[model samples]
Target: MSFLHLLAKKSKRRNVKLLRHLQDVASIAMKIARNGGLDERIAYIGAILHDIGKASTQFQKTLDVNFRRPPGMVFRHEIASLFFLSLVDEQDRPAVIEMVVAHHKSIFKDIGEMGLLDLNDRLRDCFEVHAVGFDIWMPNALEILHHLGLKVNPITKEVARKSFEAAVSYCEVKRIGYSKWKGLLMAADHLASDMESEVGDILPKLFITPDLNFYNQQSIWYPLSFIPGNDPRKHTLLKAGTGTGKTYFLLKRCTGRIFYILPFQASINAMYERIKKDLMDTDAEIHLLHAASLLQGNGESLKEKVLQRHIGASIKILTPYQLASLVYATKGYEALITDLAGCDVILDEIHTYSEDAQALVLKIVEILYSLNCRIHIGTATMPTALYNHLLQIMGGKEQVYDVSLPDNVLDTFDRHIIHKAEKIEDLGPTIRDAIKDGLKILIVVNTVERAQKLYRWLNKENLNVDKMLIHSRFKRSSRRALERLLQNDFNRKEKPCWVVATQVVEVSLDISFDLMITDVAPIDALIQRFGRINRIRNAHTIGKYKDIYVLPPPKNNRDARPYKLEVLRRTYDLLPEGELLQERKLQELIDKVYPEIEAPNIDLNAAFVAGKWRIRELYHAPKSALLDKLDIDTVPCIIESDVKLYELADNAIRLDMEIPVSYKILSFKNFPQLKIGNHPFVIPDGAYDVDEGLIAASLKLESVQ
Candidate 1:
């Protein structure tokens, strides 16, 4: 018989042949299984056979750009792949079914009711439809599997039908909890599809152990550096203020691969750059993982960008949301668990999380502990109650290296004087005087609208000094540009400028300004904002203090969103008006503001509870419902003019053009949307300003350029 040529994937550039794609997936799967402590043969066999059903002419025709299926015509290749289950041993058949059955769709309660069980109920002839051309494709699939080193036996259509029936029976009787087998195949399949032939070269570079000797150097200026990190404890919890070398201290405590978690994008980016530069001499593969991580890799090649996203870097800097997927059992979670097994994870700024986020972090800590990972937590403003709770979770003092600075040492880090103002307008005279004195001024606000209004007001003053505004609403590329200016130009000690920003300036920025005039936020958030002023602490500057003025809290809940009104009022009352903001007293003041921390009631939705997995064994959640519960929904959008470039550009460029918009805003306004890569909605061009960012209130549909 003539050899049948089948395609597995098609892009605008080229078509990927089924045989080559399977080989690549199998090779990657084998390596992952070896590293993840799974059965390598099971992974390889599952990967090789995962997409064999694509050989059916029905699936092949969909590869054509002009081909469109009839309405309500549902053909699932994964369901079709199950017909050949008899090719594997009966003992291994269950595992293979888990891998191939729902690699693309869920097994039960899937979104749109498109899962296999749903298909079975909706289509009485589902088996006949999927098995239409199985007889013709069986020999071709067997030949391909045999070439890939799998032992294949000739089987008739009837035998394959029986095998499919048995697999369906097995799935129906399967127990609860997600399947690591499914996660393995999904991870391998995604990598293979994205990297194609390059998967082999990248597989070996994963799970690298980094050299952390650079952080071993001790310094008298940084007190935390004087303490030893190589203690016998399994975990470390360090309580120290900003600029005390907490990052270096936490890094010193790590012994394996590191996943450094930060709460903000600015901080994560800063840490990634800092670590990459510090470890330039080592051959460790350091990667930055986040939504805008690609924007951070401006000069890097496409291969480097691809490498940054894949699992198993020596040091991966990211936000907790990346790891939260494991808690929710999102797709590819098994691969995450496999990579994170026995690694060192650093959770920096643990106090910055909201109530719900704090509860989620606690759950993540529990899961990390179960995975045998050494957890290191560093914080400048953690409440006493929360701190003690974490201590108990980590098995108390016996198992953790709990470190804190003495009161006398903490007094030496006092760098700001606090003053209260009635409103933002009250600081107009002070801002002008500071500008006249040639001092760099930092203005922080509670909302993006306030920041923009303040920047516009300052622009009208004609102060003849550099002025810039930064918030989270700008396009990714524009945000990168603003961040560069903030770090490179405005940060210079000799340069006097005005920077008006929102809460984004709170953490991870290495910039220091001469003075700060800001809104009143939660005590912990205010403490972080104060860190930006006079941030460069040293032996000579210990006693010196820069001034930070706090404005009164907004009255209404709408104006004080993203923070509780009661908390803001309490934080304002606790401020030491016209007095030195003593570093030692901050802990007491913070505790007073947040006396009793409330544990969020989110465990009912979590997949892990009390150190045990609560989800089904081989079934994954249909969607990230936890994100919805947390009210963390954001969608990407582009201006009308950028739609053409966005559609034609590659992933990197498309990411650069995306501006993150709150899903609430889009839904409320009912903005017209466009479907393309990322499905970014379209906005009127007039609604966006390169300098001012999205003008939501000024949006008009008539001028959609």
Candidate 2:
């Protein structure tokens, strides 16, 4: 007798047999469940049966390269997979349903409205449509299940119909939050499909504790390194200046996998590279996570790219936005929670967040604490009230290892002399003198448009200096290349060059310059910007003050965006002119500028709250309004010419051809968009350049061909 063949995934380059895919998913799911303290058997079963619906002839036909899905034909494999729920025990049916019913979509209020519940409410023959030719496929699915060590009996159409009804009933009842079962299966399925034949070899590498002995090296210059990291406290709050080995101390505090959270992409990228280099000798897995992580890769295999986005890295450096999904209970949040549970999370530069972001970070801390994650926070400047709040959130002083430098050590970190300028143009002669002296100068603007304008003005001057401009608007590939040059070439002590950037360079860039000219920002932000200049402090560089000029705050509200005018004026007034910027006085100045930190008004949208979960169980938030409220850029766009290339290229290449833009700005412009997977809006080719980034304001829609 001949048996029918099935496929879980359609790949012309390799064998994607259904049974092998099921086994691969089951193996990964079992590992994840074990690490997250969930029931391994349930996870294994859910993973195995998640894709059994692919056994249908309809789905198999669609897998063919020449196949074209008929118009109005909606076939959900996940919904079809629900027909096999009876194969599991009655007690396990609920979890199995949760894993199967909505693994690919939301049960209710899905963005596309294609959720299981949506289809059930709209179509009277939803089950009947999925049940087409069920008799022919049922035997093959059972045989495959039996071959995978699962005991199976003949499942008739009546039995499958009842399973479908049960799954629909399970999804009908309103619940208070989301389920982890779906996330567990989704994560496993994604990993198995991505890793393919290499799943077994990669499984053992995940969730392993990294060897942190590399950070154990102590030196008198770095005081934090000498302090004992293994304390009785469950959390740590370390306050130290830049170049004081705070990162090393934080690493030394971790006893498990580490999630290093920074504020900006540039900083996260810099930290990712730094950590990978630091742990290069060990067999540690260091991954970078963000919107453009794939672009940051240096010839990493496809498997490595997948692993970078997935959980279980020894050390994963990412921005706080990646973790915000958990706070809002967005899709795949349960998987994130599962991965982050009982891990060491280091929140570096906690003071760098906006008012809304501050509230989000506080909530993130509460969630991490509930998950029993070892939280470590490090900051160069933190307001007194904010410091107290974080201490309270971390269970007060008893549970936290609070570390701060003494006045003497802080005095050694005094590295900049403040100079007030009326405007950037006012310091033209000073900038020229610095350039003539062969000094590296860093100019930081408040906005991308202003940064671009400055780069143009500098170019017009015809200055004989190596100049480069960097902001958050460039394409991923270009941005990655620029960052590499910023770190490798311009950062050299012997190289004297000029770099014009925005707030992206304000935190943790690891670049030092001889001079800095910046637009006035809030006191805390200005302090962070100051860290980028004269950053390398040592016995010879101690107490050596570099000149830093600050331009007056913008006159208009639109120009002074992203920062409150009152705070900017206060910061300017408090800045000492023609004198050393005292390291100890920074907190006092920050407190003066922001006397009291107001709690962000995001409680209404937040899923997790004051020691309780506000959202329903087994259901996720439809969308994250909090991200919009916080003013984060969540949209991607590409040049018009790249549309064809984007459609043909794989994920990594498509990401390279795309540019990240603010949704608020893009929507306001109302540019024509293309719904090709990533939903990138197509802009005129003249609007973008390889050297310059998105020129949205100068875009002429009619120029598009």
Candidate 3:
């Protein structure tokens, strides 16, 4: 049948809604003419015949009154029309085919990697168009075969190629009314498919509208001067005190999608709460994905749908290792590949990673770079070695600039309390004294075994053990549960306890302690761990000052901890006595200390990663491999709702209080002590509550005297 006859049949439905669509198409064509990509005529011609295939009876199966059919059937007419157009002429076929084929996808090619990605100097470009190259599509030759004495035009190879180029050109010119043509077709098509009773089938409908203007409100991020240079393509190394708001800086300036990666589930929980509070009014889809976010809520994939809906959101909160999972991913990476391209990534607490995990992240960064992902390394106390690695990963700061807090704002850092202890034995007493004195303490220890030992000891001391112990020994679910408890405002009667933790607490968990008796380490790490205490406002200046005490070595210490421990021993030995170390001076001290550690290559990029160990390495590349063993698989990640994993711990001390509508996420008969602390945790004990928070702070202590 002739193309005209098909359009005539289309009009028979009484509300063929496309005539209005034709006008819309004409306006778009006019815009194209004025702006000029190919000629205004190409857009008009493409728009007019975009749905010529609606001439087919195949679409009538679903197209009823009000077009109660889905948009797909009607949209297919563009295919038929392209075939019809190819029958006109070779040259016309190529050009017409180009416009028709590409018009529908609204293919965004010119915004090469979100536009201004500097592909000329950076990773990649023009992917959307390149993804549809000439090899994939060819211009069709115009030819007609008489079937039943009727003329039929067939789509040929040449038609595909021209249509592809025209599609790209449309985006390049940003044709004045291109949105109108696209909108009209999309809107008409949807109107045709809508189940309206009165109106007949409509054309596919699309409209042009700007995103909501809510992002423009100016807010105070920092002293403003502490903000880093805004180079999206360059890597930035930041080392600040906790309250300096490193995450806040990264999140605030983050324009496109953001990937905030933390090490553990506990850290993720703390970061998640902060992000939720910060983005409460904003439209960003802040995801708390780990093992928990993947939980199938309400029996329907409502969370999954939200994930899909805003996969390209303004901001996404996730685990850093999850991005690591993607680095060497095979199946799940498909959907995420495009989303991650050119995205800005903020990795918190890099030093907290174990040698194994650190190796994984280093590899992850390398892969992200190849994928055209922009990275911004954020740490409360970024280690010297890490800073160098980040600079290298960002391909060097010769092109990138650094921004830090001014000495003046940093000098105002008389807010912290530092106490030097000689041994780990000294750590407990110091922290106990501080907590008894109403100073919430955060203690950072080197090992998981040590964290557990400290927790038990502090519990024996009748210190509130509930506020203590955040480490890897506990299941991730338990760790997240624990962080929530620590962050809550306990009653005046209840002891606001101290947390004894491994490095897990240092990086992303948002809770803070009043006084921290941390074993000293690198200056950057010391500053980061201090972020947990008095983070929001100034220090509490009542009664005894809640000082962030750094535990010093014994009077005659023999064995000290490892690198972290050694760093702390050296730094702790420097303090004469109680010193109110400011953030900037400490930062300068760290700069001086880590000079040897601040290097990109780290001596062996391939060797450190080449060891044999725990994590199951599955996906492989030339020099790197995906550590599958470390990966907590999301597919089987969830256990039965009644499984013991979700059940409360047996020894948890129960506290009966009306949990807030928000806080009461999971409730049970014997819920593990997320916040139910019976004994008191001494504030002076600080971040190293033994098993709870540590490593992330860059601290360690003398083994013994």
Q: Which candidate number maximizes TM-score?
A: 1
Q: Estimate the TM-score of every prediction.
A: 0.96, 0.94, 0.53
State the lDDT at 451 in candidate 3. Answer: 70
Per-model CA lDDT versus the true structure: 0.84, 0.85, 0.46
lDDT of 3 by residue, 411-477 (tens): 5444665666556675666666766676666667755656766766777778753465766534333
Better of 1 and 3 by lDDT: 1
CA-only RMSD, every prediction = 2.0, 2.3, 15.3
TM-score-based ranking: 1, 2, 3
Best by lDDT: 2
Kindly list the per-residue Cα lDDT of model 1 for residues 459-528, writing each as its tens digit: 9888888989998889888987888789888997576789999887888888889999999999998999
Mind giving the per-residue lDDT tens digits that candidate 2 earns over 1-705? 112367787763565989889999999999888887789999988887888998888788888888998998878888889999889999998888877777778777777778888888888788998989999988888888888777899888899989999888877885765577777887888778878889988998888899999999998888888899999899999988888999999999999999999998889888988988988998889898986546565588888887988868999999888888878887778778878889999999977888878888888999999889999999988888888989998999999999998998888888899999987877788878888898999999998889999988887877787889999889888887898898788888575678899999988788889999999998888888998998886777877889999998887787788888887899999999999999878878888877786667677777887877776555666655655556666688899889899888877888888889887666756677877647788788888877669876867767766
Error of 3 at 90 (Å): 17
- Candidate 2 clash figure, as a count: 10
- Greater TM-score among 2 and 3 belongs to 2
